[model samples]
Target: MEKNHEFIRYVLPKGKTFSGLTQAQATLIANHINSTARASLNGCTPFELALLLLDRKLLELCHMAWIPADQVTLKPTLLK
Candidate 1:
């Protein structure tokens, strides 16, 4: 929730509206965010945590995939 919204706000340009975002753009943002390492997770990314704790079928249903560390992009330009 709040954290997810905050991440989205941080990744999008100022004054940009969510309605203008395409599905592909949204998925890219989500993938990048999940792929990023977090201190709260003890350096593990959300994607890694999910892989360890969640069912593979559920993840597949959600279209989630592991983004390589070197390939993860957190910048607003990710949507561009």
Candidate 2:
């Protein structure tokens, strides 16, 4: 979260995708999420969220992981 704070354009409430990002920067965000307090997420980890999405192709776990970050913001639903 703090990683993107420098780029308020990404969290503009209206969102701003397609922005420039490096693999290292992405890893920073992932690590930040991994190190944060996730007990409020029903005992699930952020990596698990990504794994589940790839395994089940569903966003049903968004409530447990948190929206817009846990899952892709694309409109083309990966799961019905």
lDDT of each prediction vs. the true structure? 0.82, 0.42
Top lDDT prediction, candidate number: 1
Give the per-residue lDDT digits (tens) of candidate 2, residues 5-63: 54333323245453565554444444444433356557665656565566533433332
CA error at residue 68 for candidate 2, angstroms: 24
Clash count of each predicted structure:
0, 0
**lDDT at residue 21 of model 2 (Cα atoms):** 56
| Residue-wise C-alpha lDDT for candidate 1, range 14-79, written one tens digit per residue | 697889888778877888789888888899999999999999899888778788999887667777
Off by over 4 Å in 1: 1-3
**Candidate 1 structure lDDT:** 0.82
lDDT measured at residue 41 in model 1 versus the true structure, 0 to 100: 88
Clashing pairs in 2: none
Positional deviation of residue 34's Cα in model 1 after best superposition, in angstroms = 0.4
